[model samples]
Target: MDEVEVVVAHSERTTLRVGDVFLKVDADQSRLDVEVAAMGLAPIPTPEVLWRKPPALAIAAVPGTALGVLGEPSPASPAAWAAAGAAIRELHDAPLPPWTSRSVEEIRVDLDRECEWLITNDVLPADLIRYNREIAEIALRPWTPVFTHGDLQITHVFVDGDKVTGVIDWSEASRGDAMFDLAILTLGHEEHLADVIAGYGDGADRDVIRAWWSLRSLTASRWLTEHGFDPNTPGCEFDVLRTAFEAARG
Candidate 1:
């Protein structure tokens, strides 16, 4: 295409926005399958599917700017955050996806592995790692699996004014803990937490959500690094981890 912009380029996938079309290129067909299925099942607004071939799926761009960016304060007003929160609540209240989510045991194993890697590489203070791990244990308990947009990063949401226009990136959508989605969306944007919770109405556990902040930061650093983004960048994942540690100590 004459005017193509690479929105995301990582080891796992590449997302290119050409004009009004978004082309996602991934080697894994199974993930594409999940994306297509999840989009079909989601109760909220999502990108329109233009077409799909192996290794690539093209979707019509939704109208509006992204809700926010990672490691940055959301430009969206509190009302936008609230609108996004309502969208998530609607999705969570829908029927569970056909696929299974990560078990607590599976998460614990990954946590242990990532924590060891972080310490071995001298990525953080050992005490910080230890404290976060202890705090993270609270989120490992059983939860009622909801239909979650597994990677609900701020960039995945589209908004016009205070209204949510669409949500994107459904590959990670599955039956999972609802708080995990909430945590992922609000990570690194702590100021918006109350806004989101206000929109969500009730029955949220802030402690568990914060625990996920620690757990996700601890586990995702390696993958993010391999994907070209530096998780250690100031005000990013490392900062999130440090924040979690301080909160636990207080």
Candidate 2:
């Protein structure tokens, strides 16, 4: 019998690993629908779907390990980081998905709301929240839409040696800013930004990417806390914000 392992469980969904297969359970079927559709449309490799039953979707585990974790140093070589960047460029260049993503105004509104919540709830220092929010403002500018992996977290990308094998968790995939995807991939892994840009080619604005770092950290900290995650973990969102603050001060 394959031992069932709990991968992640939150108010919105749960993921379980049974042998080589991963099962995702979400109350919202639309997300599952999008995941299936995105994987099918994506140019890069994605996990093979084994089966789907209403609220549950089963997929064969893709080969290779995740590129890295949020709060840890990546052991992957610079070439592997570049490879992941190349894969992201390929995905961004593909046809736009049918679903539209949150507009810049929507994101700005959300950021303001989350920042207020962070201050009111004492989730973070008011000064820190204010500083990061100021930095986040630059990312509110308009951008060209692309086929983006909405939640392109470092762990979502899998690579073997220097080659990208698959990218997972496509529920958030949609027509969105390409920079947002790049920002998410390098959120806590700023050290690899140069390598990633090398493979992604030109026109990656560092200021916009850095602004997204602040925007993402500020907006996501509250949700992460509510969802049983610690944004204060070393080298994570809070740390990223602090680093930004320090850089601005000096």
**What are the C-alpha RMSDs, in order, of all predicted structures?**
1.1, 0.8
Give candidate 2's error at residue 232 in angstroms: 0.5
Runs of candidate 2 with Cα error greater than 4 angstroms are none
Candidate 1 residue-wise lDDT, 36-99, digit = tens: 9999999999999999998999999998999888877778999999999999999999998899
Put down candidate 2 lDDT per residue, 1-250, tens digits, no spaces.
9999999999899999999899999989999999999999999999999999999999999999999999999989999999998999999999998889888989989999999998999887899889999989998998989999999998999999999999999999999988889999999999999999998987788899999999999989878988999999999999999999988889
Give the best candidate by lDDT: 2
Misplaced by over 4 Å in model 1 are: none
lDDT of 1 at 128: 97
In model 1, which range of ten residues has the least summed lDDT?
226-235
